[model samples]
Each structure stands twice: as structure tokens, then as C-alpha cells.
Target: MNGRKNVVEVLIFKKEVEADPRFNVIGEVSLEDTDMLDHIGEGIDVKLIPI
Candidate 1:
């Protein structure tokens, strides 16, 4: 993180885990929201908000 621009990625985990820098896990989604993961495709529009 030495002045590098941050990157965001989406991962579908079959197991739960604590955040790890090696995996770049900034956060996670709820179980109910997992359904949306199946719909990701070429035109996906994503936005990140720092709540």
C-alpha cells in the first residue's frame, strides 16, 4: 500500500475468513447477497463506497 492506487475485487468464498492482505480482502457480502455473484459478466458496472 505504499502510495499505490487501491484495487477492488469480488470473490465468492465457499468458506468464511478474516481479511488478509495476501488475498486483498477489503470486505465481503452477506449470504443473501451471494445470488448476485452468479450474475457477474462482461458489462458489469461496479462502484465502491467507503461506508
Candidate 2:
């Protein structure tokens, strides 16, 4: 069997809400992991939309 790694990467950035609004609104995006995971894939624009 060919072995492959199912890996995911994450990067955390700290910034003022004015510098990056997305950082301030992560908590309001969604409560489900699927909702977050859906946005974190290849070619997907990773961002947290303020509700």
C-alpha cells in the first residue's frame, strides 16, 4: 500500500481588529468544526468573516 500523510497546517497571527478584522471575528464565524475546516483547504481563501 502506498503511504500518504493526511496533513493540515495552521498559522496564527495576532493583530489589532483594525489591522485585521478577521482576527476579531473568529468566534462569531461558526460553532462547528466542519464550517471551519471547509474554509481551510487547498485553493480556499482562508478568512473569518465578521458576522
Candidate 3:
């Protein structure tokens, strides 16, 4: 994982719930874009927080 690149943390807000869930994913942004976007598309909002 040390030699890997394009790691990002994302917060997903699930529908039917009042809060969001945080997830850590290590990989290229493009690789996770669809799933992450779909999570948001399916009523889960995404918020990228700086660390």
C-alpha cells in the first residue's frame, strides 16, 4: 500500500438514515468514481473532507 497512489477518503450518507458513513479507499480516483458516485446517486450524498 505504501507504493500505491491515488488514495482518498470519502463520506457516504445513506438514504433512510440521518447520518453518513465514512469509508477509506486506496486506489485511483477513476476506479472508485462509479461506485462512489452511485452511492451518492442512490440517495447517499458524498462529502470529501481534507485531512
Candidate 4:
């Protein structure tokens, strides 16, 4: 692979998921994250399936 941007699709189970009601600021601020990790990795608990 060359030094280029690569896109990887990840599959996460809906079971192991938790979210904070207060940290939901995605709609409030699009693109940039006023929170940490764009609120995607932050304020959320999830596990990716190991390939």
C-alpha cells in the first residue's frame, strides 16, 4: 500500500454500547468536536469485532 488515505469499515455490535445523554453535541457542532474524539469515541462505550 502506498502512503495514501485508507478507509476501513468496522463492525460494532449494538449490544456493547453505552452513551451519555449530556455529551451528545454532534448536532450542536458539526465536523469539529467541542468534545473529545468528536463525541464518537468520547462519551460512548463500544467494542469492535476482531477480525
- Candidates in order have lDDT scores of 0.67, 0.46, 0.45, 0.41
lDDT of 4 by residue, 1-51 (tens): 688976544332223346657444222222343343443553356443433
* Stronger candidate by TM-score (2 vs 3): 2
Clashing pairs in 4: none
Ranked candidates, highest lDDT first: 1, 2, 3, 4
Clash count of each predicted structure: 0, 0, 0, 0
**In model 2, which runs have C-alpha deviations exceeding 4 angstroms?**
14-51
Q: How accurate is candidate 1 locally (lDDT)?
A: 0.67
Q: Among these predicted structures, which one has the highest TM-score?
A: 1
Q: Per-residue lDDT of 1-51 in model 1, one digit per residue for the tens?
A: 589977655655646778777776666777787787677665576665665
The alpha-carbon lDDT assigned to residue 49 of candidate 3 equals 50
Candidate 3: regions farther than 4 A off: 1-3, 15-51
Which lDDT tens digits does candidate 3 get at residues 1-51? 688777444444332344335534332344445566554554444455543
Q: So what's the TM-score on candidate 2? A: 0.23
Instruction: Evaluate residue 42 in candidate 4 and report its C-alpha lDDT on the 0 to 100 scale.
Output: 30
lDDT of prediction 2? 0.46
Which pairs in model 3 have colliding backbones? none
Indicate the residue-level lDDT of 20 in model 4.
55
State which candidate, 1 or 2, has the greater lDDT. 1
